[model samples]
Target: MSANTTSFKHVSYLWDEAEAAKLAGDEVALLIYRSNLLGADLRLTNYGGGNTSCKAMAKDPLTGKEVEIMWIKGSGGDIGTLKKSGLAALYVDRLRALRNIYRGIEHEDEMVELFNHCIYDLNSKAPSIDTPLHGFLPFKHIDHLHPDAAIAIAAAKDGEKITQELFGGTIGWVPWQKPGFDLGLQLKECLDKNPGIRGIMLGSHGLFTWGDTAYESYINTLEVIERCADYLEQNYGKKGPVFGGQKVQSLIKADRLSKAAEIAPILRGFCSSERSMVGHFTDDDRVLEFINSNDLDRLAPMGTSCPDHFLRTKISPLVLDLAKDEDLSDVKAVKEKLAPAFDAYRKMYTDYYNTCKHDNSPAIRDANPVIIIYPGVGMFSFSKDKQTARVAAEFYTNAINVMKGAEAVSEYTSLPRQEAFNIEYWLLEEAKLQRMPKPKALSGRVALITGSAGGIGKAIARKFVEEGACVILNDMNAERLAEAAEEFKKDFGKDAYATAELDVTNQPQIEVAMKAAALSFGGVDIIVNNAGLSISKSIEDHSQKDWDLLYDVLVKGQFLVTQAATAVMKKQGMGGDIINIVSKNALVSGPNNAGYGSAKAAQLHLSRLNAAELGADGIRVNVVNPDAVISDSNIWAGGWAEGRAKAYGITVDELPAYYAKRTLLNKIILPADIANACFALTGGLLSKSTGNMINVDGGVAMAFAR
Candidate 1:
């Protein structure tokens, strides 16, 4: 069957003979290998969307004999990255015994507790809820996947008929049943009735296939999906037009992306009424096709048929309807529709909970759509983090594929409302949600910081990321930015940090940096204006170039960054924070520091004016004054320490002690101390305080704000 699956139009086979040969004897490794292959392609399964299992013989510690055990992908684990530790190991004989004691489908959920008693390994992860399906089936190896192509057929009105038509008698069909002991029994019955079948199409669910070996089962799943996809493609092509043809023309690429960015923050604000949401935008051709199509109105509200798709995306997506000739660039027009659209969606979701929720159901979660389908642009997906938001978009695209395939061939069918509600608010699912760690201080926030390649700037960037903020680290040095980004990726993750080559003094570069923040993680919620240089010189020695360099990076840089970032803030209607990394020199008199001190004073005054101006927009401006953050400071690295020491009538080696003794507390300051003050201002601690300054200088009384 794998040999015949040489060239697949809709999906990749991805089975490697050399790779399989390495894990020939380790049944569990082969299972993981096969599962990864099936999960590698989105055409096969969405992220964390499917289960695979292998029934093998292992030596039993208690019995001192070989016993049949099942190794299956664990609950909440993705098959594509399935590790041995991620696999739940259970006694196959014990798992099968639970069927005998099952009261009926009405009390099938009780079986989950019974599964714990059958555990063969103490350290294995919790078994998936589909354990019954794998254990009840009389196969050595099994694959249950929510491949879009297979689901399209499973969700068709004539799904059962389509299964037989495509696979002849090689694959049987089971009626619609949610995953539980009862559905397991139904699958068992269908297989018992059909002699020598390759797999079964579980109605409004997914495809299940089995074989004697892991490779054979993997190949069978692929062959079944390929054939179903091929059949659907033929019928889809013969039927003409996706989603009943386009009703509106799509906006051009630049206009579309610009529009998506323009509306993204507004949508994010609306979705974040209960809690903040990071957003991801996609203008893929298929998404545009669906949104611009005539049938979009009819199909989007019907929701997704697959449980996996519905889980991440919510029960249904909110569609933003627009007229055929609506002006895509008129953001004001789109903005006006958004409030009513979101209000209606919230009301609908609330009604769904009221109608479907039981007394024991977990309290209603945030009643906002995870996915928003917009006309003229594309889709916007929102979640607690960038990665989750991206994954939500990916899952919705899978649903789009399913809808396209189903509608083209046969009628696309959504899951029954009650079933979807049941699955969404299921007690087991609620437990999983409850188990997740509490959100961090800056979760769902995006921060843009300049001069973040080193010193206090990079320190602040790292702290924001640690507190759950996605960051755009900006620097004039591209190499330094790349180096910092790699450190961030290594320490935290790639999704947590992005880099933009920016000279804060360059207005155009600052604008580009702001756009990078928007395009990477929705929009900016915080800005740290920390980029600067020291050009210390006496009145006689000061040059025009020295003054411009000091003022350009220190004073002008802050202004440009604030201007660009605040523009985005006002559009979001969510407000934001701007922190200026000022200096003790801003207030204290110093020698050989005329250019640097005046620029610092300018930065300080600009921050105060901004605080007063942007307060109406709910934007806060604050300042952090550090006396001598010499360690890891870019200013010090660029010969500022030597200049300051020479001016103080001391050597560079004694500069730290000299600055420390001048402070009331007699302590040298560090970058991390400055970073902490920044976090306190923006991390919700000083939420009500703005236009204020925090001294992280070990008590510089002379520089204290009066």
Candidate 2:
């Protein structure tokens, strides 16, 4: 069971000489290299999924003592080729001190401050979320990787059996649990039990390994992978036609390049693999076989190698039978056929969730697969980085191997629906949500705001607090939503506001978050679909993505939240008010604002429709269109209003006046003006007026119809 007696041979390509050298001498270099090594294995780690650490000594500023310190990777840094500057040097003593505090701390801010006070780093990023775990480990050099092979065995249907066979007594296995303090605590116990253990495998997550020397740790990683691969080959021996495809290399190369273009703008700076080894492997039979496997349902219980792999590979890949002579060259045609296949996959996911989830759980995650393969065309994988891509592919590859082996053993079953939901929505796993303090908005009438975390959303949220209504601020940034909630509490006190980090476009999540918010608030009484985004570009410069994103938040998001709120409003029997933060574009014929204008118009209509349908239920809906709101926020801090002012032949200072002059009343509006209007609609002052568009634009009107 000792690391010395483990017979596994090293064959892992997870490290190079540069990394090995860093581990041997410089602790700083070792820390950076170890982080980069973990980052380079994305299939095994992703986005901000993994953590690594190295121990050293720091001269304490206050105590003037040489204190034991652990240099851990700062949060959100890419581990692959990580920089030395990316580390936060925390007092190992402080980290261990926190670990020894058996009484769980109630507030994370207290813990965060304690960490900040002790950790010395020029890096501004937060400490690695796994800092507590690093403190618990005794090794000098610790590495955590989301290795597909290792996680595959750990997440397998007979994961226990597979893990016992591969590492046997050499590794300690912990069942799937939320990472962070809890998992770290469990790991500490496991380590205590297996005192000589060289590594640990977290079920349904990734692998952790460490050693006295860097080479030994890296080599141990290689050895463990080789053992797993060998075990897969021996037990499953899955060979040939793992996938089916022909050499349509030229077509695939062009198609992949075009696909890369679609993703490039969003990914920003990651090195692309448009036609690299990754692209070639995905096109191979092994990947295809993994995707097209018939035993997906039975084997999926093993779980993904890690949760993030779901983002890349989806819950699983889709297998399709394309029609002969289908013109994939016609991009629209290809997209059309691909739609139904993905739809089928999504349907399967829903069925799985419904069958598996318990009554008391949030639903599963985004069902989009990480990889998709076309029989002759090729395969495609998505990730934030190359390491992520490789790790995901490896997971997909080995997941199939495990499933194939399981077919020979017994019926494969995934975690029950409730169990999976628990994992996905574990409070510790849902770090984003747990960080935000509960808003007092939960105690009174409900209020909904669109784009609730950005720009005017934050403003209106503040205003609603002033009006004594508990507000539900909706936004895409779950993290930002948490931060905003803190700000709201600080500004308006704890009872004033709550947030639903709900993507307005995704109706399901919106529904879920809304229901939760309503239940938390007792009932909803107000809604302001203030969620909107604007791209000041002419029609020719507008993209489908831009158009869709604008519409989804402005029109669709508003409509969905309104619908959910109206249902709750009717039951509450108390009158409710919905205010739409429509733009001047909705009333004015403006160039370079086609999408925002059109979506705002739709939003205005949706508002009117709500006014018409729900007015009988004691609910009123209205619109507030602001012409030019001079604000001190980021959106208006730059080229936006300046460009508009220039286009109108005026200086930036004269811009608000120029807009003001167009209105009968030469008044410059603030978000507070719109907020005042929303307050009026929600309060008793405007109960008589429903289905109205109250122009807050100081009498500006480019189109005077209706």
- Candidate achieving the largest TM-score: 1
Clashes of 1: 0
TM-score of each: 0.95, 0.48
Highest lDDT against the true fold, candidate? 1
Expressed as tens digits, the lDDT of each residue in 26-129 for candidate 2 is 77676676566556654335555567777877677777888788877776566775677767788777677775554563333245546676665545456755
Query: Which stretches of candidate 1 lie above 4 Å from their native place?
Result: 1-6, 322-335, 657-668
- RMSD (Cα, Å) for all candidates, in order, is 2.2, 14.8
Candidate 2 error regions (>4 Å): 1-25, 35-49, 100-118, 122-124, 238-282, 296-305, 311-313, 316-321, 324-377, 380-706
RMSD of 2: 14.8
The whole-model C-alpha lDDT of candidate 2 against the native structure comes to 0.61
* Clashing pairs for predicted structure model 1, backbone only: none
- Provide the overall lDDT of each model, using Cα atoms, as 2-decimal numbers: 0.87, 0.61
Error of 2 at 147 (Å): 1.5
